[model samples]
Target: MRARALVGAALLAACSSVTPPGLVLDVGRTCEDIALAIADPDVLPGWKIHAAALARSDEDPAWYLASDNPDELALRRVPEDMPGVDLSALGGPHEFTLTRGPIEGQVWLTLDREDEARLWRVDEAGETMLAGPQLTGFPADTSTGWIRRLVFLGQSPHLIALPRTTRVGEVPVHMAAVSPELALGERWTLTAEVSCAPLSELNCPLLWEDLRTLTVLDVAEPGSVAGAALLVSIASLGEQPDPQMPPMFQTHIISLTVQRDPSAERPLLTRRDHVAWSTDGPVLPSPAQIAADPLGIYVLAGLVPAPDSSGANATTADYLFRADVLGAGTSGDSGVIALLGKDLRSHLLQLGSRVAIGQRTGDWWHVAPIEGVTIEEGIVGSLEVGDRVTLLRAGRGQVVVVGDAKPSRRVRIACADPDDGSETGGL
Candidate 1:
């Protein structure tokens, strides 16, 4: 580990060529023109440019930022002499969070408006059509219920809305909803709690359980859209041993399955929520992230209690669990396949057969394995075989292979031990 860290530090020192704050371009260039220009390999190789008009600025040639390190960012500019595209506008009136679709060259957008939130599908020509139900009266801020997470499966987008607590008379009541099994390009009905599945009750007292993050594990019979499974993490207030002490919280993970409704025509969907498994104590920290694979589900969270003092922060670790063995409030951490170190960061990615874990210390970046996988030792940032780690700056999705910046980077991992030389189970 020490040797690998040292090599990573050296590479970090060598890759500090670009240094600036904002991207200044020719006066006539629109954001669309810049996006098209960046796509050309001759202009910007390996880097992805997400084009959108600056929220606060309506002028041409908006500002853009880049970074040698994800944390130590710098705004760089395009030379002022380049030609510009003759586009009329950069974006529409409404603001939205853009994400890459499951298929290549496809894009999904979530319009964030004050009165409601809606999903749309954007074609290559930049035309958009409604993809899912509009979340009416959803407060865009953290003060009220909002769209927490969005997962795309085989062209279907599932939305999980965050829970909102409100006072019913004098008692606090929780309310939450979702748009499940959304088949894009099809006419679908939109209801407040229709997608909550078996818990679709209008007054289902979601109680203190606040939805955090979720990921779809498997779509049983995806060809027919027969059924699907997902893992959801919920957080609730923990017992207060001392009334004056700061409130504590516990996170719980549950498995939800949705199947085609037999009674309804046109393959309507129905779901059932169950406690597929449980871990002892408060293992998961608040606002944990979950992702699914063939082996099982992996959660990225703090393995240790958070620091009580203010102004102190620490990175979380990644834990992989078996999907088959988990069931009925299982006790202990027996399901855990691996427990990564605290120094490792979240956002685990399946590059080839192995699950990659990213770590950044100061200017250096390291990619390591978190499960039954093996990566070449001393490998930093990019892989030894030229599989470089780059952020997919074009969308809100996880890291993809290339040289753009999002939250983390990606690399491939081998599923066999170099010493014994046998194939092992991996994610």
Candidate 2:
């Protein structure tokens, strides 16, 4: 029994001493050496060790090292004169562009005295078309409720509704009798009057009471209902009353919900007295870029949250969250799956497994396992981990990991006694 106990202790000690292999490269190393290892002739093709090194090199250095070290530094210092890649040449609007595909649709805008109307649609070959100059008494800022279905409260008291659609002409809609909001397909329209009086003077004192009601006549529904739903989120702005002095501004999440109505003309959309999401305090600055996938909508906001705070004054941490229409009230779980520590600038390409996070304070990017411990250094360019570690190139990117790869387990034994080696042990 004592002999067995000794063998077990030895095995435990041996296992504990065997640390997992860490990053192969150090900070400040160039991509040339790491790339060479990936293409080495001596290393067996598809070997696990070689693959892991390659994987680590592909991620954005910033995300790879954010958790590894507390003191964040800049990864690469590109010269100001260096020729930067022009992403705008990739064939898309430099600013935000909303379209189902290559086709142009209808856009309606009304501001003060000018009511500009244009019809846009994409052809079968993916071409965009712009037509018309419609006029109305609605203010252009009021159209905020229309574009992207994202509400942006204007500086003035005017309410805007801009809904893009394929159909043209004035459709008989009695919105004043029923509700002041109407939802058609992916677009939602609001028809509300502007009030010069401050909200404090109203008897209700709440913005919801002052909203005008809108009603739609004949309505048609979309063909598919599978992934179609409306989401609504409300946030409050302004100062919280403090007895010590004047009130101070603080932002907070007020409400989030998802609705299943075909038109999305629920009662919640009529609340104009309340503040819009974009106007809420703790405002998130404009995002650098925005994209959508099966998972959710991603907005690459430039501001990065400071650790241990509710994102009041952190400059290094960028914010990424799933964008949803406020009235839709879809599941909260759907937005912003991963909050990366690095800035949006470091995220080169975010695909399945391979992600490139830019590192701080070095020419080389830090590469590490996407699922395991984060590695921050000045030498690595990109990092990935799967069946093996991999290092990505600065110019050439790597494939994203869509799923996990299981590793094969093998057992080996080394016996100290040659004579006793002949004895066999049962599996």
Candidate 3:
């Protein structure tokens, strides 16, 4: 019965562009399950998928896959029927998506240009709705390309264009929000210096962070978006590399919440809250897709194993990882959790909360939470040293469960009062 239900969910996701909230995971599911659920359906081999937008055709809710080929770009409707417009003239689409707007679905696209960060809104047939007056203060870098992402905020409808770093190691620390009307000459300031030398393999510094995905929720007003989340990937040099082999890169994940101050001349985007996991060794964590629910944020990612002592590579492990956003007070008795290995894939380490299911090659451990440890039960636990854990949410009275399977042994997630400096030992 469970297998049948899983298949139905996968089929529904494949047929629709919208990601389901409860599709994060269940017991006995792996990370690849979520990855495949959110992955784009197979398009023609040459075309690179740029974005997935809501289909403009119906009220029932469907999606269109926008892809780019060497010659031009096109939108292929899901379930494969409706013919879409040929967008060859858009000039190599950077970021494009359809958002709920003045009418219903507005197709927005950003162009690949050096002087200006171009924003274009077109119809389902690819005819322009509004086009002009490039976003001001866009970096004019000829050697490198800039990537942009767009999202709609509230009923008053403010369109936000977020900039990706022009080069690796350079984090674009600023964001902009434009009203429904495409106001001209908006400016952005750079908070960090671009130090990455893409060509120089050995000398270029490795510590870097890049934005992966963005989600907005609980919009109080056109200017006040309460829970705007950004999934970021942070990379650093794992181990000193041999002169011959390329350096091993260790990647980590970060969930950042930014607040918008609408009162500023140009609405300022500032960090409000963040959850990060400091891990040991070099594990290449690649988060391909991310989304959120009322509970927390979830990421479908590929975690590549660090190179062994022999310097040989291993297959990447796909897993779905969750970060607690809502506190236990609202989420009820217990929340989903899982225990993952330090090496990305191996024997399970200290049982931790948050659901993380890996590839088939790893053992799925079963464990139970020790009750009466705290009012939140064993949900709020102390993070162990060298374990990939994020205790940042515990300060907010959040509890995360570690394992999903019905197991015999008892495992306790220690509790710590962030304010009082009080902690209970793990069992």
Candidate 4:
């Protein structure tokens, strides 16, 4: 570990040779990007990034601060509201405040002995616990102590599989969304080595310095993802990859063209409140609504296959779940984000689908939908696909299935090894 840490520091120095000296951490990049950026060829990847830290840094890129060592760091805990088991019986004397038990919120862990480790809550409960193998049951590279003592407190043990290497630099790592906010993928980078840079000086921010360690958060970005509230006419391209345009589809691509008039079937803006977008291209729309005459506009909407896919193009439903509306948009290519109305959203999700483009006279462009768009709780709409609708977080023999970020239904989950328990068959 010590040798790797030194090597990691060397790699960081190498980064400075390539990157400008003033900005050690590229604030413009995502946490995942920065994490991979600072990785050494032999460093091991970590499971999670500090969410709170990322959020803060995003708001203030200049405020890149150092944090507690991730190895010595405790994993965040499940929300008190989130379902979890009561392992209060698994108590100990090494625990400074064993009374509260291993409660919820952000946390940390340390080895108490060879057989047991301590779990500490960084929240109000101030709980703690002495855990065993089942707790460290995650599949990390034991050689580097990746998942050795650390355990994220949750209703169920979740396993996060990572890649053996990384596509370092500003490259995009395709990922499957676990929820709207969380996506899962592997970092095919080197074994990780933590860096030893102090924060008091103008040393690179702790967050970026972390990349110097062997940690790569499993997240996604297709170079960049830009969303727009485009009002498009729905249709399907032919059943094969169009010969001239790099074979876009195998079984008829879900296709679209710009629709100008709101009266004759319009495009619905996405996520935000407004609804105008560019008709001349697949460029994402700006915040303010901009209306342009939607005549004679043609942008080639291509469904680039997944990084490893070589089969038929996605099904109509599949295409919608992986929608990519951004493009090298042309001049006069623009749109808005205003609310075209609730009914329009419904029409696009349900009614507006399966129809031919509104005005069929000119060249056509296309796009597809990705999974889990937002909708109000009580008033619902269909996300449709089963896999896209639910995601899993695994640990040991345990798994957690999240329906969606804001699921309306009640959920329950239980985990932990029962053999070590005193009561029953190890509570």
Candidate 5:
């Protein structure tokens, strides 16, 4: 408890995306379970795979060297230095299928662009390029060409994707396990790392504390019992800097796919999906209709409305992430400053013309001044019971010089008036 308090204090002193917390579970028990699980010939097992040799792992075939088909050998090595635009010899059209179960997929490697590891799915319906782990109602995220690692878990296949780091001595950030099941819920968990590197700048350095979604993919039941849960790191700064202007923010999302199973009683991790770029807008149809997409079919994997300041349910009407307008002098900075201030406390602010909040009682909204909001610490404040706030948007309490548009959503705070029913702001 003391250590947690200290960490919380440290977080209060500076902005941080994620801090190490007590093991979401203990390490010793988790390791033993995972060892026994991988003891099951890896998550995606049973396939005698052939392909250009890939980085190998004895545990699962998902990490084994792979190739295009049964007859042809995959290219293990590429030319040291090649001229531009040669797509012919990059690598094989890699294919994979479970010797059992309903798993089947393909990849076309683009050597020139490592991140563009093209992915596809082939099923009874037909074969088509698989674009993403697009979540419901949210935007679909595409990746640059790179696939560092893959693992498959559970009775139904769920994937875990890891990133490549050059340091040989580097330690892993996550662990997972899976149990082969005969039922709809394929139990699995892959301790895969989720980082804010793409969203936070180098100086900010937002690495996840611990984020994973345990997806229950009920194949027999289809959407009936399928759902996802997410725990993403908040955008945090390693060190606070002098604030000259409000920080600009943006959102970055990842496309995930399920690969391998670890053992039993572990977290289920989704795979990172890679797709070629699109000029005609998003590359796939609305996730709603996409077959095999865990997200479109399952309920989104994260908490809604996000916990509030007091760790209560949030009370937000609507919010939008806004980047600071470049070249707009101090006048432009005013709106940015207010929007980033304490929640409903940004009463003395305006964004795109709307910048007023009030005290609420039933359907009534009473207008108030910035000073009218209840000050929490004399530094931080809240929209108190009877208080309502309006602004262009309310960020997660930030004055970012830089930020993202992702995982950022508006939450409505429930109004709980004071017992005395005393009114402060004018109605």
Candidate 6:
């Protein structure tokens, strides 16, 4: 009986995209059960009554829960309190069947062959299905030859093909195990490095072994290229070349293809060195941390002193620049670069459009503008080793600098907000 009901429900769900305006269900309600009830109302004569109770049980003043009683609770049903279910898990509820009920009483179910995960709706019309849990499975290993690398292109509720597979004109396949937490109209790409074994050890000896690159594409449409953001890049470092040597290692660069306009000549933008090693050793950056920001991605490459190197021993003049990502494919020298700061090793903070640089000479600590020029003198007062300094932008073009001084430590130049005009102070 359950088998027949499941099949019938599946057929009904496949046949229609619209659900009646007053049905509702819980977050984890089985589709097979709902289908049997929906297809033949007699199967569950009091299903609507149970749905109403469930709706009222989960009602909150913040949102309107679906319910059978429009006057008492309104025409919506409360969502069921199903543990371990998340809206992000449902993949936006595109393929589920919708039913309405109690104040928050809407229900949805997945037709996916893998799991019994179900989606819930807040309304009976099924126009808005809530998210559920993601199904899982091992993706088929379809490497015709030794796999070199894999890149992620775009993610959707539907399955996606691996980047290398797509390149070879193979049918796009998906790794059913990983489902991203994405919004509607948002896209993602994942690039994976399968292996880094040297092709030839006799002629060209490779320094590092077991290297890989993974690049992710968050947005791909041509019209949205500039707004497109990189989620993250993950790379694994090869073992240290020499245990006694100063961290020698090789890096595998992951490139991204930024899609421009569909009709434009060459809608793809590729960047090499998008992923690089730190000065210490070859280690890939974390993709989870990289994807957290929506504007741009940054990979820290350690500090480099200015070429002059004068006063470098006492005080180094280092400039921080964005790592070159164009690799060898760039032409005409128009590439991305970060700003330069005079003294960054001591105090370094990058927030929005401003960067804070701090320095201590004798008793006083001084700060300078990251961009424009400023004139300020040294060590007016003393400060303790662990004193905290906070700088706030003063009104009317004025700069406010605050210093928390420690005992026995005189006020040195605590903070510096460089104004266009000459400003001098002693604490």
Highest-lDDT candidate: 3
Candidate order (lDDT): 3, 1, 6, 2, 5, 4
- The root-mean-square deviation over C-alpha atoms between each candidate and the true structure, in angstroms, is 14.6, 19.6, 15.9, 27.1, 24.7, 23.5
Estimate TM-scores for all models. Answer: 0.45, 0.31, 0.46, 0.18, 0.19, 0.30
The sequence of per-residue lDDT tens digits that candidate 6 reaches over residues 1-427 is 0111101101101223333231112232211111100111121112121111112222321122212232232222222233223223333322222221212333222323222333233333333435544333223343421111112223213223332222211122232222333212223334322222357434221233333333332222111113222333434433466778764433333333342346843233444334333334333321111110122222222223224332322212222222222233222111223222333223332212223233443334444322211111121112223335432221111122333442111111222223313233333
lDDT of 3 by residue, 150-257 (tens): 534333323333343222334454445554456533445533232334586564433533333222221211111243445455455444447775555444443334
Residue 45 in model 1: lDDT: 33
Q: Give the TM-score of candidate 6.
A: 0.30
Q: Write the per-residue lDDT of candidate 5 for residues 341-390, one digit (tens) a residue.
A: 11322222111111222222322222311111111111111222222322
lDDT of candidate 4 over 1-427, digit per residue (tens): 0011100001101112232211112222211100101101111123221221111111211100111343332223332222222332443322211111112232222322323233432333334322323233223333322311221212211112222222111111111112211222221122221122456335322232211111221111101112111222112122233555542211111111221224733222121111111121122111111111112111112222334553233211101112224422211122211122211111111101111111001111111111122111211111121232222211111112222233311111111123533211100
Report backbone clashes per prediction. 7, 96, 11, 49, 58, 50
| Lowest summed lDDT window (length 10), candidate 2 | 1-10
Root mean square deviation (Cα) for candidate 6: 23.5
Where does candidate 1 stray beyond 4 Å?
1-96, 112-114, 125-149, 158-162, 165-233, 237-247, 253-287, 303-334, 352-354, 368-427
List, residue by residue over 355-410, the lDDT tens digit for candidate 1: 34455443334454333222223332322212234333232112323433322222
lDDT for residue 23 in candidate 4, whole number 0-100: 11
Could you tell which candidate, 2 or 5, scores higher by lDDT? 2
What are the runs in model 5 whose C-alpha is more than 4 Å off? 1-233, 237-239, 243-256, 261-427
Global lDDT of model 1: 0.33
Clashing pairs in 1: 20-75, 21-75, 22-75, 22-76, 23-76, 23-77, 24-77
Q: What does candidate 5 score in Cα RMSD to the true structure? A: 24.7
The runs of at least 3 residues in candidate 2 whose Cα sits more than 4 Å from the true structure, single-residue gaps closed, are: 1-117, 122-130, 135-240, 243-247, 250-283, 286-290, 295-312, 319-336, 342-427
Residue 412 error, candidate 4, Å? 28
